[model samples]
Target: MRSTLMDIAREAGVSTATVDRVLNNREGVRERTRQAVLETARKLGYVTPPDEEGGNANAPVRLDFVLPAGTNTFIANLLDQLVTQAGAQDGMDVHVHSIEGFNPDSLARQLDALTGTTQGVGVLALDHPTVREAMRKLAASGVPIVTLVSDILHVPRLGYVGIDNRAAGRLAGYLLGRLLGKGAKRKIALFAGSLSYRGHEEREMGFRHVIAEEFQDLEVVELREIRDDRQRAFEETAALLKRHPDLSGIYNIGAGNAGIGQALQEAGFAQSVIFVGHELTERTKRFLLDGTMDAVIDQNPRVEAREALAMLKNTVLGRRFDYHPPRLQVIFRENIPEF
Candidate 1:
């Protein structure tokens, strides 16, 4: 059996109250006494208990979450769900901080600042060398990390809880190709978010691969580095429509479905074009319902948030978790649940 606070107090030749003060880092506990208590606790492998109900605990675990800042509905909803779930957990407090954009230097600075104060971190970070180095530093500080949505390749993270972007992209490609009719020569326009995002990059790659391998008649014109800006997307879509009047399909590997849908509507090509995109946000859901968006590759943000919190608790509390395959759900217009 693992040791308890009482065992730690007895072994350290201190009272339970003193041990509590030391463990919780409360003031008035002598340095020497605190060291004794900590040493005893470490030697005996004493795990802290979960916080009790209806009372503030002596010590609470603090977790920091780093994400990208945007008015993007999907990300906002995901954060809201994560905050709700974290608030419900006993003794677990989550503080969310976001960088203005997917800038590695800014994200690295944020990670560096959290090294000592945070017990754990959940990141939706850009896949860059500097960000990876920061994650390594956090890991070295004995802070566990859980990655959300986007992944950091080869970093020793606790776990990743999100959709398989490549697979989802392939699904979108398949839907578009089939809807456009196999062997029908058609020009398809692809609008992507920043390629710095691993998820977006992977989705674009999968989309291209599927179009090349499965739908040879379909040619993809990729618009590069179009951040999820609605106005920009509208302008870009209008330009693409004007440039390629023969365009028969559109694929959005990122957010901004509303802008794309509006452009298609204004061009009077909504029913004629095969459109596919990611996420089922309020705007996208409405588009799908109105027959503007052909399909949406839905990654359930609620489920992702729930699993992330569960994984974080497991990691921090040293609880064992069974190996389960990554959870990725595909939501279509017919299957989209009412919120």
Candidate 2:
């Protein structure tokens, strides 16, 4: 017997309406769920029926990816990979809309404009109240938004595709504490992208929590938000180093580790302090090899982009997804991927 819509829906664990949306190429489904439905359909020998009016058989799947714009090579590279992956997929069309920097008002405006045009949205956004309100409005407009890299709290996002940020931060703290040992009286500084990014903030909290509870001897200095600018990061690190000459460690929860490294090197303290940061970018990788950066917590950008696209597909197609826990990778000098 041929597989029916109901059968596909049952297998995919989504509503029949969702299945219909997927079949008819309508929007409003979560990307992950849409991928699940389609995968299930294909497994069950389900095929989309041809249009009766001899319309285009292949209806394009439209997805909008919204991201913060800056000179951050990691995010830019990830978006490039996402675009390539999306383009390679058959019967799918993806559009990318980048918000110029991390402005809440600008991001909201971009979101508002994409509401009607995009089937679904994938966002790497700050967790500001204004941003949350924009997401709420987008959800109300029948557009499912997926949070990428950073999470927006209490919003009706379809799903989040990134590492457990708090866990990553905790791992950093654990490593730092172990390396520094007890009664060290070492000072550890935290560098963040912006207080706006929920992921960075969560990382800071996790790092602080572990350091305080487990490693009480180590003193955590104030966290500095660098506005996601390399120059600013450099300046901030220089200022911190000048102020705290006895600093023993630095935790960077942002994308300016290279700048931090440079500042440290210029201050002649590169080899004196233990350094850890997020993301395994090219610069960070090189730093790791040269013994500048001790360790990096890598959130696989390729995997993130792939998952985001897959989730967009599922949401648009009204399909279900197999629940998979996101994984975090610890990149050290020995395990960094070659670019």
Candidate 3:
């Protein structure tokens, strides 16, 4: 007697619907399950469907979204968006990993381990020699990587999904100079989470370049690294006020705006100093409302998350997608977003 689909289902320990799908080369069946059904049919002298030879076309592309462990509101929100998007996509399985302590060595290890299995990865990169080299090697070995807010140049990543950091910095400088006025020479302070962050460095370059070309009178006294810690930011801002009593402006290139705002408030310089920072977090929003923070340069993380996913999906599917850079927002008190 000729073997039937029911024979394959019962012998292979699967439902009749599953055996039917595998026999007819339909999707929604896992590779292992399909293979098992195929092997069972062969043993039972059942004719295998010719369509099954091409393999599963609708298999989920397994991916990993690597995020740094931090309290940066923008990054935190970006991770959330990516997870939500992954859950909604039928053809993708995404696992979000937040590396503890953000040690590049640890990140590289995790990435190297995923080389064989993962289809693609999206990273909020830190600019370090080993980290860049590891990513480059991974991409060379067939795994594609895309950098998010903080990018790296060493690796030929699928693309970067963030604002033009230099332009953002230039805008900050322009706002600072405009708000500071041209009547008198004033000192400016630059605060960043770390100079090692390519985003921060790029912003600093653009800010300084613009300040030099357009507002020569506004002196940039120093670039302070507060490690993205609120206490450090508060201490640094307070120290900056003490050191540069005549400081007219401050531009923060990273998180910890809460500390920046509080320090300015306690020092009795909140209204006097022109304060500009990055991201539109609740902390910054409150500062903007209370007149502590004058301006915010927001790099929309939600938009970035969507863009990254679209671009990466195309890459995985071996297709092309248009790469459009997102415009950085220069927000003020009156233009605060409803969200």
Candidate 4:
């Protein structure tokens, strides 16, 4: 015999009327109660109409995005684009959560919490063991996962939506090398948000590879962590300048461009030091214009947001999606586009 509302209600310890509300997507249902009712229904083979699963007949699918909270202009821009684009699409229901700091434990907890609430997930991954384990669990439980900006390896992610980070890093290295010239020996500083991020680690590797192979004269004297905070970046840069007064170049593997630029200006090395970094923001634009920054290797966040959303939605609906990596664009002062 087929299951009824009364059966689900009794099994879930809720009234039939409560079950009705949950099944029909009515309000006043507590999240825990709703989860209980839904789980009991599924367990008892109480099939609901396709449209009624998430909400009303025309309800949209829910997708959650996990991103960094306090720092990084590029991430903030990506979050804005995701919200705007998701709002425009009637079929997409987007929720965004920003993690305060680079804590893998906190990120893992957030991912674990989304198991029952969202149909799909897109995350700016922190490549740590705990976070990767959480992703594995989510994938095993049938929620489709897609990585944005950075990726976690050896996991079942639908796709990664971003530029080729290795190539971008190599390009930055080459640019810095050419700007500094091959004739003279010089010192360079490298900054990273965190090596726990796969993209950052890969960029550092690529940059080092290029510097070693092509620009042997340029020595990477310091490798520092900025945590993507402007203040932290400023302190690190200031200390670097004091230690190595002849710091000829800098390649930031991630964000925090504003802090580094400010530090350079205060130390009177803005024009002398060749600064190259990632992302093109309002602050970076000003730096490039004033000759404080040489070049910026950028990826289109709009395209990344679109591709990630499409990948999640397609996976949820059992459809196929094409993964097109965003092209890397080198932004110079002459070709800086107006926002």
Q: 1-339, model 3: which lDDT tens digit per residue? A: 545556778899999678656654568999999889888877775642456524645777788888877667767878888888778877888888888524779888877877777777898777888788888767755566889888898575766889989889999999998988887677999999887789999999999999999998888887899877788899999998999988888999988788889999999999999999999988899999999999999977778888888777766554446666667888899999976
Per-prediction TM-score? 0.82, 0.83, 0.81, 0.84
Residue 258 of candidate 2: its Cα lDDT? 76
Clash pairs (backbone) in predicted model 1: none
Per-model CA lDDT versus the true structure? 0.79, 0.82, 0.82, 0.87
The parts of candidate 1 lying over 4 Å away from their true place are: 1-58, 323-326
As a TM-score, model 3 comes out at 0.81
| Candidate 1 lDDT score at position 269 | 82
Model 4 C-alpha lDDT per residue in residues 1-339, reported as the tens digit of each score: 545556778899999668756654568999999889888877876554355556543568799999988779999999999999998887889999999659999999999999878888999988989999999888665566888988777886666788778888899999999989977788999999999898999899999999999999999999998999999999999999999998899999999999999999999999999999999999999999999999999898899998888878765553445667789999999999877
Give the per-residue lDDT of model 1 (tens digit) for 1-339: 435556777899998668656654458888988778877866776543344222434356788888778756788888898899888877788899978656889998999999778877889888889999999877665667888887877885776778888887888888899989966578998898788889888898888889888899998865645577788888898888889888899999988788889999999888888899888789988888888898888777778887877776665554445434345555666888887
Q: How close is candidate 4 to the true structure, as a TM-score?
A: 0.84
Lowest-sum lDDT 10-residue window in model 4? 48-57
Model 1 has an lDDT value of 0.79
